[model samples]
Target: MKAAVLREVRTPLQIEDVQINKPGPHEVLIRTAAAGVCHSDLHFIEGSYPHPLPAVLGHESAGVVEQVGSEVRTVKPGDHVITCLSAFCGHCEFCLTGHMSLCVSPETKRGQDDEPRLTSKKGPMMQYLNLSSFAEQMLIHEHACVAIRKDMPLDRAALIGCGVMTGVGAAMHTSNVRPGDTVAVIGCGGVGLAAINGAAIAGAGRIIAIDMAPGKENMVKAFGATDFICAATSADVVKEVIEMTKGGVQHSFEAIGLSKTAEQAFNMLRRGGTANIIGMIPVGQTITLMGAAFLGEKRIQGSLMGSNRFPVDMPRLVDFYMSGKLHLDDMISRRIKLEDVNDAFTEMKTGAVARSVIVFDA
Candidate 1:
């Protein structure tokens, strides 16, 4: 199968033919239909985050099951599915306690001694996440994906895998935004827009979308943000948000994942409000907050995959999309095939598009 292989940091992914293994007892094999070139993938590609080299890099996707291992019962051949990076071990303390997204047990992947799931003539290739959807196929643990209705468009459904789930989950589960609450999202990319849309669905009275991009008013407004704030790097963003909400928003989300903006998200929160950090900050970087700030009961927390339980939440997200309550069509800025994955990352760096999905044939 053809896949985009990331062999080094600060380099373009080479589109090459790769090899895939059949399903393990708990694995499911999928024929990739559509995969979203997500910002998360870009993080790894650009060295913002590190991963093993010579890996197939993609996680947000939806496809049809072609085969299932003997022990895989969650889905069957011919089922439409959305893949998630948060592959759970199902019986870990996290999963047992309703925190499946936090699971990171090695049990989810084959042991190093065992045969690799993917390889090239050079050697064994690491799978970027449990699901490497950038390729024409994905061999993943059954828990890493969930079945959605066949009526849902696979292209749109692909967004739900990571960006949609992360944004919405951050709003509904991580911070638990309440009706009538005022909220501000720090970035207006795919994840940020999803947070705004999720805030709307959660009934937030005021949703503020922040971005520096021109021509973003319509995009943010379409996703249910009542107001748009054009961010200036040098401007006092916290002051702007505080003044707009008359004090501060009830909740502020740092979706951009930078130390500067993470601090701003906390500063823009009202007393007792929570700031959820949804972006993947680079390792070794730390965020600092004033010591006096905590006296006001202002809190900051990190959210993993929007604190998702995909099997339950994902299908409901599909229903939300199907019902027209969730705005997804506008999130897709372009649909390109796998060969054009590199250009999509370039567009992402410019922050000019919401999402670019790899429709196997797109």
Candidate 2:
């Protein structure tokens, strides 16, 4: 199978003929259909997040199940599924407690002594985030993917695997934004736009979209942002948001994962409001908040994978997309082949494309 392999940090992904192993007892082999190039993938490429080298880097994807392990029962060989990184051990404490996203049991992955699921002519290559959909095929734990309706487009379903789920789940589940509430989302990328869309779906009275790009305002507005704020022109984003909302918004979301933007998200919240940080901030960065900010009951919290239970939430997201309530078609900027993964990352760094999907041939 051909895969885009990251040989080094701050380098281009090399397209190589990699070898994928057959499914183990609890595993499934999926024929990659579509994979979304997300900012999270760029983060690893740019060294914002560190990982083992010679890894296949892609997580947001949807595909058809070509084969399943003997123990796999949730999906059959012909099922279409969306892959998720949060592969949980069903018996873990986190899973039992209904926080499957946080499940980190060793049972979810093969033991160190076991043969690697992926390998190359050089040797075994580490799989990125359990599901390396950049390849022509992916061998992953059955729990890492959820079977979805066959009617859903693989390109759009790929978005729900990560960005859509993260953004929409952050608004709907984490912050619990309600009708008549006001929401301010920092960053107008794919995830940010989805956050705005989610807020709209949740019936937020006012949705504010913030970004440094002036070109994104119209598209952001179309995604349910009632107001737009260009952060590049504003010297103080918190003040502008407060003034825009006639005080501050009831809820604020930070999707850019920057220290400044995270702080601004907190500062842009009204008294007794909540701020949810959805971006994957780099390690060793500390965000200092005002000591008195908590006095007014303004809380700042982190959201992981939209606090998702993929099996339940992903299908609903598919339904939402099918119902025309979710705007995924506009979110896709372009579709490229696996060989163009390097250029896709370059476009991601430029902040020009909302999403660049890698469509694989069956």
Candidate 3:
């Protein structure tokens, strides 16, 4: 199988013929259908986040089950599924307490003594974030993916695997945006737009979408943003948001993963409001805040994979899409083949599109 391999950081991914192993007990092998080129993958590509080298790069994806391990019962051959990075071990404290996204158990992965799931002509290869959907196929733990309705298109379903899940989950689960609340999302990229849409679905009375590009206002508004602010043109984004809301919003989301924006998200919150950071800020970067802000009970917290419980959330999200409530059709900017993955990353850096999907041959 051909896959995009990242051999080094701050370098282009190399397309190579990699070998995928068969499913072990509790594992599932899926034929790659579509994979989204998300900003999170760019984090690893640019060394903003670190990962083992010579690993496959893509993660946000959906596919069909080609084969299942002996013990796998959640899905079977021909089932359509979406892959998630937050694979959980069911008995972990986090999972037992309804926080499956927090689980980091090694039980979901092969032990050190076990043979690697992938390899190359050169040597052993690493399976990235459990799924590694950049390739023609994936061998992953059954827990890492959940079966979705077959009527749902795999390309759009791919977006739900990560970017959609993170944005929507942040608004609905992490912060619990109630009806009639005000929300300001910092960034209008795939995740940011989804946050706005999620906030609307949660019945937010007003949703403010912020971005550096003025051109994104129209696109952002279509996704349920009641207002749009160009951060680049504004003198002070936080002040502008506060002024527009007459004080401050009840919830603010930082989707750009910048320390400055994270702080702004905190500063733009009303008293006792919550700020959710959905972006993966680069390692070693620090966010500083005012000490006195705590007096008003303003709280800022990090959100992982939108605090998702994929087995339940994903299927419902599919239902939302099928019902025409989730605006997924407009989110896909373009579709390209596997070999064009590099160009997709280039486009992502420019923020020219909401999402670029890698469609695999059937």
For model 2, residues 1-362, the per-residue Cα lDDT tens digits are 99999999988889999999989999999999999998999889889899999899999999999999999998999899999999998987899999898898888788899999999999999999989889999999999999999999999999999999999989999999999999999998889989999999999999999999989999998999999888889888899999988889989999988998898999998999999999988977878899898999999999988889999999999999999999999999999999998888888878778999999987
lDDT of 2: 0.92
Candidate 1 lDDT trough over 10 residues, lowest sum: 229-238
Best by TM-score: 3
User: What TM-score does each of the candidates earn?
Assistant: 0.98, 0.98, 0.99
Give the alpha carbon lDDT tens digit for every residue of 1-362 in model 3: 99999999988899999998889999999999999999999999999988888899899999999999999989999999999999998998999999999999998998889988999999989988988999999999999999998899999999999999999999999999999999999999999989998999999999999999999988988999999999889999999999999989999999999999999999999999899999889999999999999999999999999999999999999999999888898899999999999999998888769999999999
Give the C-alpha miss distance for residue 320 in model 2, angstroms: 0.5
Quote the RMSD, in angstroms, for model 1. Answer: 1.2
Residue pairs clashing in model 2 are none
Report clashes for each candidate as comma-separated counts: 0, 0, 0
Runs in model 2 with CA error above 4 Å? none
* Alpha-carbon lDDT, every model: 0.92, 0.92, 0.94
The list of candidate 1 runs beyond 4 A from truth reads: none
* Model 1 TM-score (2 dp): 0.98
In angstroms, what RMSD does candidate 2 have relative to the true structure?
A: 0.9
